[model samples]
Target: MAKAYWIATYRSIADPDALAAYAKVSGPAIAAAGGRVLVRGTPAQVYEAGLNERTVVIEFDSVDAARAAHDSEAYQHALSLLGEGAVRDIRIVEGAEG
Candidate 1:
């Protein structure tokens, strides 16, 4: 099965506390579901036309695994913090075989 990759680009974080809240909820959720965070932070440089200021990348075993993680109760619990705090864009893509 192809691996699943999550790429998120975001900006305008008005409340760092919201990120803190997500860290508390989503960190354990990702760990519990075997997801790994490949990268999380500002990029050294972004050349894309619509690129956001911050970026995050995550990897899961397969598309199903990624879907499961997104649909999980724990992640939903984490999402409660998103409103009014920041704007985000998330994408899921299939990775190539090694």
Candidate 2:
């Protein structure tokens, strides 16, 4: 099966402290679920129509694994800590076979 990627792009951050708190918990939760963070940060440069937003990409063994990680109790608690802290767009996509 193709690897899966969890991509999250933060459109806006209203509370940096809240985001930090969520990250503190979510990081461990994701690691426990077998996710490898591939990239995380604001883009170095923006192309046409691309906003300078914070983006994170995490790799998982498969789509099901990624979904499970997102739905896990630990992640849910992290989400609660991040409530209304920021606006983000998240997606899970299967990687192309080499």
Candidate 3:
């Protein structure tokens, strides 16, 4: 199966404490679900569209694994902490095979 990438871009953060709470749980949850965080942080620069934002990319073994990680109980707990805390766009996509 092709590898998968979980990409999340945060448009705005409304509650820093809540995001901190989410991070506490999310890392362990992602790791437990066989996910590896490849990139995470604010972009160093933006070339167009004024789209500067914090982003995260996680790698998973397969598309199904990425979906499973998002649906898993531990991640659900993390989501609960982050409810309404930020505006973000998230996607899970299969990576190109080399």
Candidate 4:
């Protein structure tokens, strides 16, 4: 099966401190589920109607693993800390095989 990718685009950050807390646990939660962060930062350029936002990309062994990571207790705890802290758009996609 093709690898899965998790993409999170932060539209707005209301509480940096809370997000920082979320970041702490989120990394380990993802790693535990065999996910690796590929990119994380503000986009250098935007075209069309793209909103300026912080973006993060994570790769997982499979879509099920990606979903599991998001639904795990560790991640859920992290998300609780992030509640109302930021507006984000997140997606999971299967990567094309070469």
Off by over 4 Å in 4: none
Q: Which of candidates 1 and 2 reaches a greater lDDT?
A: 2
Q: What TM-score goes with each of the models?
A: 0.89, 0.98, 0.96, 0.96
For candidate 1, write residues 1-98 as lDDT tens digits. Answer: 88899887776787889978887888789778878999998878768585547888889998888888888998988988665678787888889999
In terms of lDDT, model 4 sits at 0.94
* Location of the lowest summed lDDT over 10 successive residues in candidate 1: 44-53
Worst 10 residues of 3 by lDDT: 43-52
Clashing pairs in 2: none
In terms of TM-score, the best-performing candidate is: 2
Give per-residue CA lDDT, model 2, range 1-98, as digits (tens). 99999999999999999999999999999999999999999999999999999999999999999999999999999999999999999999999999
User: Candidate 1 local accuracy as lDDT?
Assistant: 0.83
lDDT of 4 by residue, 1-98 (tens): 99999999998999999899999989998898899999999989999998789999999989999999999998999899899999999999999999
22: Cα error in model 3, Å: 0.3
How many clashes show up in model 1? 0
RMSD of each: 1.5, 0.5, 0.9, 0.8
lDDT of 2: 0.98
**C-alpha lDDT score of every prediction, in listed order:** 0.83, 0.98, 0.96, 0.94
> Which segments of candidate 1 are over 4 A away from where they belong?
48-52
